[model samples]
Target: MSEFKRAITAEDITRLQVYSDPQFTPDGDAYTYVSTAINDKNEYESHLFYKKLNGSDATPWTFGNVKNSNAQFSPDGKKVVFQSTRSGLPQLWVLNTDGGEAKQLTFFKNGAVSPAWSKDGKYIIFNASLDHDDDVESQKEQSKEERQKQNEEKKKQPLVINRLKYKSDAKGFHDNKRNQLILFDVENEKFTQLTSADTDHGYQDISPDGNFVLFTANLNDDADYELINDLFTLNLKTKDITKLTDGKGGYHSASFSPSGDKIACLGHEFAYKGATLSELYVFDIATGERTCLSEKWDMQLGDLMIGDTRLGQSTTGPVWSKEEDRLFFIATDFGATGLYQVTLNSDLEVLYKDDNHVFGFSYDPHSDSFILGISTPTNPCNFYQLRKTSELVRLTNANAKYLEEVHVEEPETLTITADDDQEIQGWLLRPYGFEEGKKYPFVLEIHGGPHAMYGQTFFHELQLLAAKGYVVLYTNPRGSHGYGQSFVDACRSDYGGGDYTDLMSAVDYVLENYSFIDENRLGVTGGSYGGFMTNWIISHTNRFKAAVTQRSISNWLSFYGVSDIGFFFTKWEHGLNLLDDPAKLWDFSPLKYAENVETPLLILHGEQDFRCPVEQGEQLFITLKHMRKQVEFVRFPGSNHELSRSGKPEMRIERLNHICRWFEEYL
Candidate 1:
């Protein structure tokens, strides 16, 4: 056995560095990525890092702890353009690889994001939200005193709500500003507005010949009532926009082939209600022939895997191979993500498979290698290199030193039989300092996104529980990704039935196989969807001694109107809207069965959480209190739905402390 170190603590999470968004230069000789670390103010700051393909040491390309991302190299590989917040607002900046400082490129009022380079390297396209009648340079010169006066006046005025989608958890309250595509000429430094529509347009890719730009937008009059985004191609010469995908489903991540003959995209037609998996599709530009390449693959063709408070977005890309006849993308399977390649003939082959989450990756056709950002159960994410010959190389060790000083447990994978005779996948994590024949209190950790999977990723909350001398177990039940569409769709409408049995079966299997787990001292906890399951578990049985639910949904009936996405999410998940069948909504609500609860429960919620509003937690607390059951509620002020993963550092630490305290008091 290795030398024993200290158990992992919540404070350790702050010291670790997160790596994401690896992109190789056009020439494939070097690559750049984003490395984020929490500053002294407890805010995340990302910097750009660069490395050469010859296995050279990595170094910071852009200094300062400011936010820098979306680094893309020009065709000649001499200049690199990226988005940065150094000037207070995020804007485009360019830096020369050989030498020189990064120069600011855009001065738009709302700033810019998702920058894409033209093939000729003379133009850079970006997305920015702007008011319909604002002049770019004129708005930039607005007096600071005048702006403050307007802000003060607006604060004193009443807030008049009119839009259907008024509030969002991530971006906050809605402004009338809409995101639109804009083109910038690198030589003249001119910003041109390409398309102006009431709806938003996101930049995707530039055609190979540099004559067309690909994007996605929803121009429907009632777009707020539906969830649909169609693909489109705009000609730069004539300024003509061509619709690619039919308005039947949602689509994103559209990429053009090298020959400009085909386009690869990732989306679904909402086939199996809200639980349908995203499938990859190929579009023939000439014939308008659309083909679903991954219709029968069963696995979700995008990154739905979640973990620690990593800063950058977790997005999947369908990059075209050098031959232009094949596409490379990532898919979730079981508890990990696998990179696969599909030929035009529909021959799918797994190129890289592992029991870890591949958060982001970039391919270099020149070297036939991939720069991968990966995370394991014991390690936070870092960069690695995978060659065509199947050779693996570790490129970055951002968390190696910290890991050496801590005791991290690698979970053991297990397969248990569900009540329906189906197989359930789970992992059992022993305490940091494990001893044979020593029984310990067990904790079953459930994941949210009954649609999302519990993967072999580094989950801090579960690790903290294990560090505190508890045997932690988590699983991907029938209603999770990576196991196929049918399994994920199975948990819908029957919230607490088969899914609950699958979890119990996992606990039973672990107790029967691992003699060190004390069956009598079992506890359970989860957040979001997991929170809902936690509530359902307590109501359905008294086997668990204690439980903690975070940002949970107690009543589907109320969730329909309260949650930001609840109106449609309720209909999509339950297959029935609130008005269509209120009784059905109540049938799955945990609040309806709170009277039967016997276990001591702890409810943790974020006050500003609109996804599963704190009201959900309040309703459950009130119900349990009315029933005279043992329950405690902890509300985090000024926090949102993503409080656990990306909330303020102090709040997250307090949350962990609350859970540990609750468990210690009861368990």
Candidate 2:
């Protein structure tokens, strides 16, 4: 280690840059990606950056504090279309690649997003929200102040509830607006409404010959109670709609082949309810036949690795080759995400596999190469070019300066056998400044999702703990993804049972093998599911000196009704609803055993969090306080369950500091 290097701090989050959505130009000469970072105002700023294939420095194409992302080049590679918030709301904007001012392309009322150019480059397809009773043409005539007045009037009236799914964590209560498709004619400079259905639609991909558009939507009458999303195609000339997938299964991330004869997607039929592993599927356009390509593969498709450092969205699902015989996609297995290739005959091959996280990638069929967005434990993100004949070439070093000044610790992987003979994977990190024989306090970090995996990604919270002189440990338990199907489904219907044992087994394994960790000075913390485990661990035993729970569920009885996904998620996970078996739900709750807690605990929650809901934290805090136990509660204003991941920048830093402060004071 160099003497000039310094330990990382919670505030260093502002200096870290995140990269995503790498796209190569049609000519394959230059590529563009989105780079995000925190500004002085404590807000996120993202911009599009462009670079050539000849090892040139990347330059920013857009300026200012506004977010610019999802850049797609035209077929001829002359112009780039992207989504931007510079117009107050997210809208479509176009910029000439040959150097000129960017032009705002859409003036829709609710804003247009996810712009995809047609094959001929004469039209652009996007999605926007529209009310059932509202006319698209009339919305353009209405001024911003007029819309504000109308919204104020609507707010004065009481909200009438009629649907089961009325609220969500991302968007609060449901409104009358339903997302619909819109087509923009570049040559005519006019807007045309494509589909005016009452249901929301997702824009997937445009056909190669420009005759059809692929989308996903549920038009069933029982859509309010159903969870299935079926793929559909809209004919441009006839304005006709055709269903592609069977109504029994849910599908998404669909894209047409080079010849437009087939469509590839990632989906499942809910074989294990919500725990089903996604499989690759191909549909014959002419015969309406769907075939499962990866039926024998037992891994989840897409980037399931969870981390707090990633900012922008990335490309997932299947990307076709020039010959159209092979397809490329990202899949999760063990603890890391890797890029893999599959053929129509069900042959699979690993294209890239390592201990790093492949968050995004852009494939160029013409050159048979890819621009990959990868992250490691020490690096937030960087772009790399991969070729069939050459080794991985580093394209952009976005965090080179930060890495040079800070010292980050790499973790040692561990495999522990559980009480049931099941193997659990974990990682251990020594304190920033450690001596060979000196003992240090240990902190056990648990990841949320009970379905998401903690892999080789840059986690700011865990790094900060290691920097604070605490030996940090994180693991993938029974319920985490990246493992096989049975492992992910093992935690369901028995929350706090096998999953709890797996975590405790990991701690025991570390303590028995690692002599430098002090057994007496131990701390634990987790968010969401991990938060639930923290509460469960402290109540079940007093081995830990301190604990912190974030956005956790303590009472399942109340959680069944309060959370946005409470009603259905309860049945899907616990295998029973509140009305089905109240006793079982209450028995699995952490609050039921709150009287046995002996360790000091800290409770943190977001006021606006609707996923787990703030009430979940409030219930546990009130119960612990009434029991005269050692507990404290901290509430973040205008935050949600994603406070640790994509919450407000300032709030995220405060959350990290609070976690470190609590552990430091007690441990």
Task: Give candidate 1 regions above 4 Å deviation.
Answer: 1-3, 141-153
Clashes of 1: 0
- The C-alpha TM-scores of every prediction are 0.97, 0.98
Pairs of residues at least 3 apart in sequence or in different chains that clash in candidate 2:
none
lDDT of 2 by residue, 404-423 (tens): 99988898889999999999
User: Which has the greatest lDDT?
Assistant: 2
lDDT of 1 by residue, 122-178 (tens): 999999888998665454623457557777987898778887688888876777899
Cand. 1 TM to true fold: 0.97
Q: Number of clashing residue pairs in every model?
A: 0, 0
